[model samples]
Target: MFKAYRFVFIAIIACFALTQCTSVPKRTQTPQERPDVQQQTLDLEDAKSSADWLEEAWQAPNDIAKNSALVQAALTLQDEKEWQKSAAILARLDKNQLTNDANRYFRLAKGRWYAHNQQWPQVYKTLEGLPEQFTQKEYKRLTLELLAFAAGERHQYWQALAWQVEAQRYSDEPSPNALWQTASQVTQSQLPAERPRDLVLAGWWRLIDNHHQAMTSPSAFSALLDNWQNSFPNHPARERVNSWVSSDSQSNEVDKSTNTIIAVLLPLSGQYEAQGLAVRDGIIAKVSETKSYELVFIDTHQLSFEEQQSKLEELKPAGVIGPLLKGSVTEWVRQTSLNTPQVFLNQIDADTSEATANSHSIFFALNPETEAEQASEFMSSASSRTKRPLVLAANTPGSQRMVERYKESWSGINEPSVSLFSQRDDMKSAVEASLGLVGSKERIRAVKIAAGKIIVDEQERSRRDISGIYLPGNLQQVRLLKPFIDVSISPFAERIPVYGTSSAHELTNQLGDNDLNGLIFSETPWLVQNGGQNVLLNQWLDARSGWELSQARLAAMGYDSVDLLQRLPIMQRMPGTHWKGLSGVLSVENQVVNRQLQWAAFKNGSITVLEEQPNAGKNNR
Candidate 1:
């Protein structure tokens, strides 16, 4: 489990140890300015609250004592759950005054603060190097745990499992369950194809991977555990596997039903009928791959709200997935008695506090904002040295949402320059204005006007301040926007990076996508798998030549919805666990399922999946 840093204990050790260190140079403070060292050491023992430590820092004899006191004050604030207050104190501390050990404590405190705020990149930057640096086992253990949690949060499951394996050496008891949880989340593709160098980690990974296949068949899990223990008799996990099997058996005995009925509601014959069918088709596709389920589909458009309620009462399904329309979903959830582990296709307008509190239902929507936030996260961690960004969006609700989300998630100091175009005709003009092309043209015109007959050899120049451009538009819009951006960049300026949403990419002929070359975008793994060499997806596309990418995405949503139905309970119980779904890497927070999508870029007029970059923003900071 992830726990807050017990800085109070470490802070006290760091405080007293500060006076004995001779590694750092002594501060050149006047003799009159310094407090009595013997008195200050005695006063430090009585310091308890943040204010008491701050008072001690103010009265400290020199820079070393002062920094130690300040560091303790910050740690004290963090231990009290006042992270922001602690951050303010940490910001002002002079690390130069502290010994190597004291500086390690300072870095740990800052990393803990960043972890509390869910700032993963900052956490990675602050603590990625401190694991081996710590002399104390407790501090090193916490650092490894933080790194593991951060890696898992970012969907770096293989890295997370490695951290878990390392953390085990410091713990008194083995955390086989925790290691298994992180291991199970690692997709087959993500796991190293060959055995890893670490035999312990490799053995555990192989065991858990086999365990996944065994879980499908009744009584197979126990047999698999026995076989694994026999094979890796001296493995670290061998000791913990027995208890795990016993715990699983006791739980399985209480609830062993496999034939649970699930109710699905979609619009079969209305304005949104096509969208509803795509989702249903996706569900059927997944069901076809797995065990046969009694999937009862209800067309919300055809049935009245009260009739839908009466039907649910009579059927009493184990779970429900649907009511695709926003209005229908909102009305459906208002009925308190109809609660049965539900997954609404559209988000409810009314507050879902009551429904999600008890883990009865979750709202899953394929919103443009979610993809935009993912784009923002990807760009933030991208290897680009872009400090300033320019966001060019269409003047639509979805486009606006993208812009808003990009700005909200952005980590840089400079605010993104956002420009919106309402019409297709304005796309070129909007891109030009945002890039300062219009201003460049005006400047040349003014120079010509000023010098009547003189020949001006000056070329138009775009702004140099924009390090990157984020454009979240549809295929056609992106096609036009990319070309506009390509041509608009000043000859004098460096090639600025451009990022877009999944909507920006669609199944199009390579010749038609020449303009999108070098443009990076966020997309679902299902559509962009195997460098767009998705055999089944291509076959489906060839079979249905007229299907739009939006329909395909809805189908993906349907497929992942079926997955969510199976995994939501586990996610609800264990908040930070992730499932690699067809749509994206899914994790639940506040009963809302969020997707961390895969990334791709256009190169030589073809889509290519981008490799996941580790420590992406290490140098950027």
Candidate 2:
């Protein structure tokens, strides 16, 4: 649920887990521009780290101080990424033997641990027992924030906001920073739970961060503020925004080095010439001939892969961006020596890539593999008792590739039991055979054979093991498959949900409405029915004619590619940072720019927002 801010969320939890933890990674800030997180950093740095605390607890003679030391030691251990060590220390504590602060501290520490492991129910139970008020004001505020975070993970945004509001007031930190921190903690799925409140908070963050933009485009900023204030008559952050504006005109630049030219390699001629042109246009739309960045485009059309590499060196650009084909991406990764930092616009096949081991190259793509990965994450994280997902897809080369990629991504992130099946010509037999479900005609004959002795009717079992189905197929196949899946799965089981992809468009085609109901999938924001829209984006799309709209995905891939150049420096500095961009919530890990997508489902006639609004409460001004 806390997708965009994964590393941030966990680090924040670790920051306060131990009174004695010293290595907790908090956001560093100058005192003049510091957020509420500064206080935690100051306090933690003054205390001993987990190792010191653990040793002190082992040596301390007094029982009261001993328990106190133990609690601190456990939390400190957690902050240091030593989960087993923390758990071992926790096992030594006897809650009944502790009193006052020690007892409360233990519960809070455990609550943090639950959050670390995503044990949401345990997080709530452990934290709910604390007193309504605390003797230490800072601890009280921290506790409330943790509660809000836990609630968010549980898809309880309303409750999260309640806690966040209280926490914000109680916090001895700047109002704007407190507000931003709280909003960041709210899970994406639960964003719309308090729409106006979230809008105001998000607007303030954008206002503060885009100080240069606000100064340059005062009218646009003012109109944005007016809309926000008018929409929520009494938002708490509305007044805070007025103070956020600064007269300073200097821009916030993401400085890398003196190297300024960026070489872009794409198919300027050949079969993919059209796609390359679209991407080029999108990049051009975002970037101007600014003093900061110079751009050069190299045609990958007539050149061999080695020649393309030679051309890249000739330009000697600061960073390279392009080569929209997957084959180029794979070769780029396998190169033993890379001269400059180059970003590939496509993802390589997993069988060929060891991206984690690669260097000086980045891969970003609107790949179906990424969509399949997100589907697996959504099914696992969504708060259902169901743990088994029967992944069924059409038995085609592309579908099979997507399925493997899905399994790879899913297996890497979660531990849920998953089964795979494929359908070709016969949907019914395929569905039944996949689940190992019994066929009636054969069973009837078996019953007839056993008539004299005994007949085991077996009650026509439904494999209760299957919680959902993943069908990555087109509309025709999906329409044919859904009814068969419904009949083949046992009636005793919960309604088996099917997760699909953009391959299955919810819009009415030859296969008409509502047939493939309850199919969930991730698509580009603009493609989805209830996606958070941007007027600027719409206008940009309208400006282009012919096939740009039809090839929107490839175009966006180009658009976001250029935008990523500036953000990469910031992301490199802060590993977990994310920002709202054209594609989706964009974040970088291991030099690869990842687009965290929005989820939707097919209902009555069209696809609607199923979980979170990816761009809702986002900064569009």
Candidate 3:
């Protein structure tokens, strides 16, 4: 009779059910179930307090009252949230002293204690394969409820739903809201192969959410229910839907904005104005390709940070994106109070990665660290026979950043990587040092000095321990650095494969890139897909050149940002889905956007995309 109201109290646990239970096991009895002991428990109508029960257990060893009073004390402890003490009270009791019913009570209580402490796996293990008779009839309903809650936490949503439904029929412990939440998690955690079952569950949740309509107007709800039943006639939820027994108040009131209005926080007039404008153009270009969304552009230079913030509040958009610099992104995340989902154009450092976790935001930085890590994984998988690698980098800030990240990526190798910063004062010497050639030559000179004579061994050569090279720099630098590496290691090692990031070269200038022959690297679709020849993309690229990140590539980045916003819901709803955009094959997880890049190489002086490692596209991360 109280099932309908039971869910309203799920958040407020009921201690009375626990404290008042004196249930005995149903199927069997033992020495403890003797008539005298049963009568002793019932006779204690004005029983001593839980403390007095504890005293009775120790003072009256074999007394029948001792066994009965101890059970009461455990219940009293459980009611007070002294879960460990409650379980301990049962554990210390003698197995021989417990009747079959008493044993059942102790096991069920211990299992419930684990659930209360969120030790879900322990709860499952404790309750697994227990006979139906093990749980007293009066306690079975709550046991089933605890089992269901634990199942949901472990992602066994199907089993969780089944257990919860059975529990609700016995006693609606987890209300419709809690049950519906379990259903939604099941949907998100489901496999793509399970889409049919997922949809059926989704339909059931829809019916549950419309419970008010089902009750207020039976005919209308019946029609909807009938349509639902027709779609999934064999669905387990059919009976629940047909019953029309649910509360509309149980449905979630989470924000469901379509995100029609977007407030952009990019610099349109200042130092970063060019890049910001390029991104804005890309955002604008996507307007015709998909759903209509209003873009409100606020130039960072024209408006003060506070003024920009004030304008954001004034517009009250469904989403916010930008503040490209790391510092701006940091401040905005710290102070922003808006509840809508916001995408920052930069990544927060380790400290900020944790801080933004609670905010309605995600990091979408163009971080090379992720790229470097993936590159390491790719190269490591590509070959182990080619000798350990050499890392040659320029002295500029960007080059150093890439080299540092590369060092982090390759930190696991037993054969140490030779990393050297080129002063550009002498590229040849730098490459030789990176290959250990300089060290080898210096050793030979030291040996000569020690002997006080000059003796050259004809077979002696520079150290040949390396197999490949990783150089991250501009196209000009790569063109200049590759040959030095090739010649420096010629005597001792064969010219190994040279790898680079996409930023190292412009594949569009095929004529000038003849010098980049044999270079292997990863590329976004924008660079690999015929120079992103789509007419709409070209138009935006033409107008936005020389803007912040004036390169057409940055313009492509701008375009992807907008397209990603529009498809956010689809990606979230079906997490396994991928959007093959200009940037890469994009996917979203834990709020961060991920890209699966393609491999390419300069073949015969013209770029050729590699089909050698088909499985390499998926990120190991």
Cα lDDT listed for each candidate? 0.73, 0.61, 0.59
Off by over 4 Å in 3: 1-259, 353-359, 395-400, 411-416, 436-465, 489-495, 507-512, 531-539, 544-550, 567-577, 614-621
lDDT of each residue in 553-577, candidate 2, tens digit only: 6666777776566554444322235
Backbone clashes in model 1, listed as residue pairs: none
- RMSD to truth, every model: 10.5, 12.9, 15.4
Q: TM-score of each candidate?
A: 0.67, 0.55, 0.56
**Residue 60 lDDT in candidate 3:** 51
> Which number leads on TM-score?
1
Better of 1 and 3 by TM-score: 1
Assess candidate 1 and give its TM-score to the true structure. 0.67
What's the best-to-worst order under lDDT?
Answer: 1, 2, 3
TM-score of 3: 0.56
Model 2: pairs clashing at backbone N, Cα or C within 3 Å: 462-490
* Number of backbone-clashing residue pairs for each candidate, in the order shown: 0, 1, 4
